[model samples]
Target chain A: MTFPMGLAGPISGLVCGVLFGYVLQRGGLGNGCRLTAQLRLQDWTVFNVMFTAILVSAGGLYVLELAGVMHAADIFIPTTFLWATLLGGVLIGVGMAIGGYCPGTSVVGAAAGRIDGIVFFAGLIIGVVAFAGIYTPITPLLGAAAGPQAQTLGDLLGLPAWAVLAILTGVAAGVWWFTRRSAASPAITCAD
Target chain B: MMKQRPIWNSHAAGAVLGLVLLLTFVLTGHGLGASGAPTAIAAAAANVVAPAATQANDYLGWMVEGGRNPLNSWITWEVIGVALGALAAAWWSGHLRVRLEGPPRANNSGRLALALAGGILSGFGARVSAGCTSGLGLSGSATLATAGFVFLIGFFGAGVLTGLLTRRMWK
Candidate 1:
C-alpha cells in the first residue's frame, strides 16, 4: 500500500494536520500560560496529556503492526545522536520554559491571536536560517555523534515490540497515577 | 459576547490525539510535524536570496534539490492545515483574543521578547534533534524509538531546571 506522493499526499497531510492541531488546541496546549505552568510543576496538564498520548500511540502502533496492517519497521526511525540530542534538548527545554511554546504549539498560539505566539514563530524561522547557515560545518559533528541505528526499543532491549510497549505503558501508568495524586494537592495555582 | 468554552479533558483529548497520530501514520507513512514547514520556508527564502549557496548547502540544498519548489511539500501543506485548524478551534472556544500572553507580572513587550528568544532556541534545537515535539516527541516515541525517549528526558529535565530559574517571570 504505497501511498504515492503525487496529489493525495498533501491532501492527507492537511487533513491529519488539521486533526492534530484541533486536538492539541482543545487540550489547551495553545495557551502559553498553561505550558509555562507545566514546566514550573504547578500544573500537570502537559504531562497528563502527553503521557496519555504517548501510551495510546505506542500501544496502537504495536497493535496495528500485530494485526498486519503495517510493519513497525517500515516507519521512520530517527537515528540517535547522544550529544546533539542532549544539547538540543537543553536548548529546547530552556526555550519552552521561557517562551512557553514549542514550534507546534506556537502555531496554535498565533492562531489564537496571541502576539507573543506570532513573535515566537518569527524567531523560529530565524533560528532555522541560522542552523542552515552553519550546516556545512555542523554536519561532521552531528554525524560523528550519531549512535546505534536501532529500529525500536524492542531491538535494543532484546524484547518483542509488544513486550517493550507493555513495560513502557506500565511505567507511564504508574507515573500518571502519581501525577493525578499530586494534582489533587494544592500545588497548582491559577495561572490561566 | 461569545461564551467561552473550557478545554476538553486532558485524558480524552490525548486519546483523540493518539488516534489522530495513528491515522496520520497509516495514511501518510510518517507522523505529524511542525518545524519542517518553517525549515522549508526558510530554504525557499534562502533560495531566492542565494540560489547557488542554497543549492550547495547540506541542509537547505536537499529541500530545494534540482530547483524544486520547497513549499510544494506535504509538510508545508500540513502546517497550513494546522493554522486553519487552530483558527477554527480558537473561534469556537472564544479564545481568539489579540493580546500578549503570560503572567500579569510580565509586561507585553517583555513577554514578546522572551517568546522570540525562546522560539529561536527551540527552532535551532529542533533542527539539531531532527524534529519538534510532534515529529520527534510524539511520533518517535509512538514508534518506540530510543532517540525519542532520550530527547524527552533531555528537554523535560532542562525545562524543569530552566523553569525553576525563571519562576519570577511567571510568579
Candidate 2:
C-alpha cells in the first residue's frame, strides 16, 4: 500500500532523522576514536550499538507487522539484487574502514564539525553522480541472477517471523557476552 | 561548554535508534535511510542539466517517476534533520569542535584524501546496493530480507579486511 508523498512524510522523516542523529552522536558513533576502534576490532562499541539497534528494530517491526498496525509489505523494502547488494556491502565496509565514517555517521560527524566527514560526504555525492552516469553499462551485470533470491529467512525456513527474531535476540545476547569478555584493559583510546 | 561528557552506553543508544526507526515506520510506513537523500540530490541535479537524459537513464529515471521531485523527498528532509540533530547533540554535550582525526604520523592531507576516497567508494557502493547502513542494515534486516543479511555479511567482511589493511589510518 503506497502512501501519498505529502507534508506528513517529510515531517515525520525530520522527527525520526533528528532522533536518529541525536542518539548516534550521544552514543559515541560520532566519536572518531570509538568509530576507529570499532573498525580496528579493539573497541566493540559500534558493534554493540549497531546490532542492538537491528535487534530492536527487528523486534519492533515484527510486533507491528503481526499486530496489523503496519505490515512489512508496506515498508520500503529492497529488492534482492544478489550480486549488487553484496558487492556494495563489501565496498561500503571497506570504505568505512578506510574513512572511519558510516553513511549516517558521516552526516553526524560533519554536523559535529569534523572536516573529514564533510570531505567524505562530497566524495559520496561525486560517487553517486558517477554511478548514475555509468548506470546503463553496469545494469546488466549488477541486475543479473534473475532467480528468486530476496525471500526472508523466515519464509525460506517455514518459520514464523517472530521465531527468527527470537533467534536474533539470542545472538545479540551472545555478542554482548563476547564483547564484555573482549574489552581491552585500558579501553583503547585514539592515538595521535 | 567545551568539555566532553561521557556518552550513553552503546547498547542503550542502539535501542533508542531502534525505537526511532519504529516511530518513523509507524508514521511513514518505511524505515530510516541516509544515502537516498544524496541519491535524490544527484538525480535532481542530473535532471536539471539534462532533463531528457535523466528521465531516460534507468538509474535516474526513478527520481522522476510519476513526476515526483526527487529533491522534495523524505530522505532529504530526514538527512537535513540528521545534521541538525547531531549539531544539537554535540552542543548539548560540549563536543562540538574541529580537531583533525589523523594519527600523529599522518598529516591533514593524507587523512582528507582518505576521507574523499572512502566517501566516494561508500557512496558508490550504497547506490550499487541501493541502500546504506540505515537502509540495508536497520530497515532491510528488520524486514528479514535475505539480501539484507548477505549485505551485512559482506559489509563486515570487507570492513575487517580493510581495517587490517588500513591500520595506519587510525592507529
Please state the Cα-based DockQ of model 1 relative to the true two-chain complex.
Answer: 0.69
Show model 2 residue runs off by greater than 4 Å: A1-8, A146-150, A184-187, A190-192, B47-56, B61-68
Model 2, docking class: medium
In the order shown, the candidates' DockQ scores are 0.69, 0.64
Q: How much is A173 displaced in model 1, in angstroms?
A: 2.1
Q: What is the TM-score of chain A in candidate 2?
A: 0.87
Q: Pick the candidate with the highest DockQ.
A: 1
Instruction: Kindly provide the TM-score of model 1 when superposed on the true structure, using C-alpha atoms.
Output: 0.93
**lDDT for each residue of candidate 1 in A13-67, tens digit (9 for 90 to 100):** 7898788888888888888877887787777778778877877877877777777
Q: What is the lDDT of residue A187 in candidate 1?
A: 51
Best by TM-score: 1
- Model 2: residue B145 alpha-carbon error in angstroms: 1.6
